[model samples]
Target: MRKFPFLLTVATIPAAIPAAATAQPVQSLDQVEETVLADDADDADDADATGEVEAITVTATGLFTRIENTGQAVTVIGRDEIEAVQGADITRVLARAPGVAFSRNGPPGAFTGVRVRGGEAEQLLVLIDGVRVADPASPSGGFDFGTLTTGTVGKIDLLRGSNSTIWGSDAIAGVLDISTRGRSGLAGSVEYGARDTLFASATGGLSEDAYFAGLAASFFRTDGFSSAAAGTEADGSEQFTLGGSVFVDLTDQLELFANTRYANSDIDIDGFPAPSYTLGDTSETQETEQLSGALGLAYYGQDLTLRASYALADTARDNFDPALGAAPLFTSDGNSQNLSLRGEYRLIGGLTLAFGGNREWSEYQTDSDTGEDATITGAYVQAGWVLGGLAAHVGARVDDHDRFGSATSFGGDVSYRVGGGWRLRASVGEGFKAPTLYQLYSPYGNLDLQPEQSTSADFGVEHGVRGSDFHAALTLFRRDSENLIGFDNATFTYANIARARAQGIEAELGVDLAPSLRLAGVYSLVDTENRETDNELARRPRHSATLFADWQTPLGLVIGGDLRLVGDSFDNAANTVRLEGYEVFDLRASYPFGDGVELFGRVENVFDEEYQTAAGYGSPGRGAFLGVRAQM
Candidate 1:
């Protein structure tokens, strides 16, 4: 691979180049779902102190949009939800989402990824504060969800289905956009909990209008659970994160904001060789750190709003395997850098248009066998329109790589009111995932693999209860994929299979029940398989459901609990490892003494049932955690 520093000259296309025939066409929308926020008018007491959940904002569409009106299947996890769940990692927070699967190789904050709609881990795109965070050096080209801690997270938006037209490559499955809030004046937390877990966080805002600057930092350490095998117990890790942002009110109509976050984590690893199934003292260790920064300007007026941003990310990793009696010394280093600029505009009468482009440069340098350098450049454009009781959305993207020629993706969706407080929505889209550097340039072989692509269709209907705080919805979806990437069993070489597919239905119901109590239930059923191989997809449960309830009493206490259930599923494409179904429970309680302080505690894995959601792995058993929070 070659560096393209001067390639910018070729990248400049005279500004008048004709659009390619394959250039995607733009579309718009009419009706959108109204968002139901935590700060809704009905809950005056809950909205008084901590600001209602409705006050929370989301950047799900690469632009700021209220959660409910996003015109997509979007789920938001706000600060209250984050704190109540006692979730230490992204996997636990997103586990309730339909068609989403997560697994980890070690303890909390370890190597982990999310699989969507039976797609491989690499097919999902992960973002932090609107910046893409996928690791270019990953063997499978996916973002490692394990690196992010829940301490700094303000909210998370999980958008299901193909989003390639809005995002770009690696969005064949969907997107998980994470947003963290900047520290405000005099706000911080110091907490320690059960299971050897220690955590501390602080955020402070400076200047009036909170427009000058702010800082947030957190540190975490935990001892992990292990299998019965030796060398697998007590293998834990630690992490530290520091983030800062500056917001300048350039003018009344325009604001300039810049922010950056850096995270450093160290993990302890245990590897075992096959045949004996005995643990070896390999003493593997890994250190990872990532830096992300973005600067943007926004202008808003009565009828027009415009915004633009430039973002950059640089990440690196170092992995080491200590020398053993027979095992040779092994070490590897990998890094990647990316730069992107995007723009969005709002036109007359609820019409919005958006466009953006990004260039990414990545490299892997190591003494180990696999090493390479690669470059990828991608661009996209989108438009949305809305009218009374109707909404439409469409977009397209193109990715040109130095190795592969180019790939294009597009999608469109629409929603309409069906009367009687009922709504119907449908969408069709195409998404693509490019081959990673390891798959294309690794010394192990197979440099001729093609990119994977998929087409998806979805339909959903929702209804609201008249004069009551109750709602329900049912969604059906199907996806067809081509050039799916996999490895050959005989030679261990990367290859593209002919096809794969997933069909599923998800239903959700929520009720206020009463002023102090709320209840929600979700059920999901999926049939996912590989068409070419005639086998079940790996690590995808056919049936899953969740029950969650939150209640507050006159005793000044808030309590909540949730249950998650997953049915049996195969572990591999060959259908060899059959994982049994299991259910887990969690509980949380919190209360405030009105002195700007609160005490909170959570019990996870309440049943302590021992089961493996992943093949040949061990998950954390029943655990308890308690912490205190203070605000001023």
Candidate 2:
């Protein structure tokens, strides 16, 4: 495979461009979620220590918008929340969101799948910085969350429901946008946990008026438990991660920025023997490497803002089995490159016009399967309006694929303030997912397969207590999907042979009981069925909820706890195999010690409930971890 030249180009952009601008501090979790509804009457009295109204730019909308003005069901997870949870992986952190669910095959570092609103894993799009990270080699063209670590990630924006009008294919469910840390400072952490798990990370950077640069690195290793329920042999994994960003202000209104992240992991796995589906004594090892990065230039004018970016996501995997001799089992590589240009211009009063274009190239190679490549080009336009207490957004996109011809998607959302601290919103959108290269060119592929399409709608209401710290929201959503691709048992070939219907309700509440205490919770009820067979879709729970509380003491001590509940679901399409429901509890504590230092500890799965997200797979039991962090 040829090396990607764009990465090297991105690394050199900062050095080439000079910079000048006032340094902006990182946004806090609450500030990042600030609503568009301003409290003019209380602004003077409610000023922060800095005496400035807290606000942030939300990127989930393609065109940046204020959080409160965003008509979609969006959730923001900041660095503070990430640190408070003490999660070992990204999946654990994401599971706390309202309409998100995940199933892991085994221990950490194993193949993991995440679903949004009862949609399949592949239907959801994952983005880091601005680059799509789906793996073309995977059967579903989905990203494996097991490889994502929380150490370098600074913020996450989860947009639930169909967003293909703004984003493109594979956004039938939603989009997970992750932004890495880019603040100037020095920080590091070291941790040790059960099963001989060890983790360490360090980050440092400089964000001054002239230029900004940030870099972070992390290492993790663990002697994990068995992957299968019947296996005793330990399956361990190790990972190394490096990420960084650089920005240079060429002028007051123009800037150049580049960001990159690379991760490499080796995992020991268990496999089934000849006839049984249970774990056997066979030993296998898989190595995976992923590199993603983006380079962009932005211009902020008086009434117009423009950005152009080039990004790439590359992944490679190789497997080996000692029991099958020294030779390798199989190897695969996948790559996707994207170039995009977007701009926003102030139109008439209270209105903005947004437009963008994107071109993406995807390629896949495997030792056993056929190698193929494809390209896609798309363009989109949107209109955004904000007047008094009403906000509205409408967008449309047209995509041309090399193999599948063309597809068009459109969406619109409206929100209106009903009364004091109350708002009502409604949205309707359409999405589509094109067939992957493997589904079209491989041996089991069907060249005549059509793209999967979906139509979704949602209605929601939100209320925030005036002059208080309480907020609540309720949303009901429905999705109708057709031409779903699945494998046929009788013919042993891939084909588009299914349709699905999914509907769900999501509710969330947050309260600040006191200056030192906070509480939050979310609940979701989903109903998904296969339209062809009238059977419940596999691996989708009907009910799920999470509750969390945190408190800070005068002595610089912080304490928190989380309770997660996952309802029952089926493991197969026939609905004959049942997976029982389960609940898990976790506790965390942290105390500031010397200057710029803190000590923290957490206990996960306190009761050690035995549960399986996937049939025959083992979930982690009760475990404890301790760590310390320092910053300068």
User: Candidates' lDDT values, in order?
Assistant: 0.67, 0.79
User: For model 2, what is the alpha-carbon lDDT of residue 416?
Assistant: 83
lDDT of 1 at 284: 68
Query: TM-score of the candidate numbered 2?
Result: 0.91
Judge candidate 1 at residue 467 and give its lDDT: 15
The clash numbers for all candidates, in the given order, read: 17, 1
Candidate 2 lDDT tens digits, 1-632: 00111112223221111100001211221121121122332443564321323222243457545445666777777777888888567876887788888998788888889999999999998888767999988877999888878888777878888888888989999888777765557888989999999988888786655467778888889999888877888888899989888877687667677889999989988887778755654589999999999888876565566778899999999999988888879999999999888876666567777788999999999998669999999998888887877888899999999998999999988878888667898888899999998888888888888889999999999875211367688999999999999998877788999999999899988777887998888899999999999999999999999998889988879999999999999999999999999999998999999898989999999999999988888889999999999988
Candidate 1 stretches greater than 4 Å from native: 1-60, 67-70, 227-232, 273-282, 299-308, 321-334, 369-371, 464-468, 489-492
Candidate 2: the clashing residue pairs are 36-68
- Candidate 1, residue 87: the lDDT equals 47
**C-alpha lDDT of residue 180 in model 1:** 63
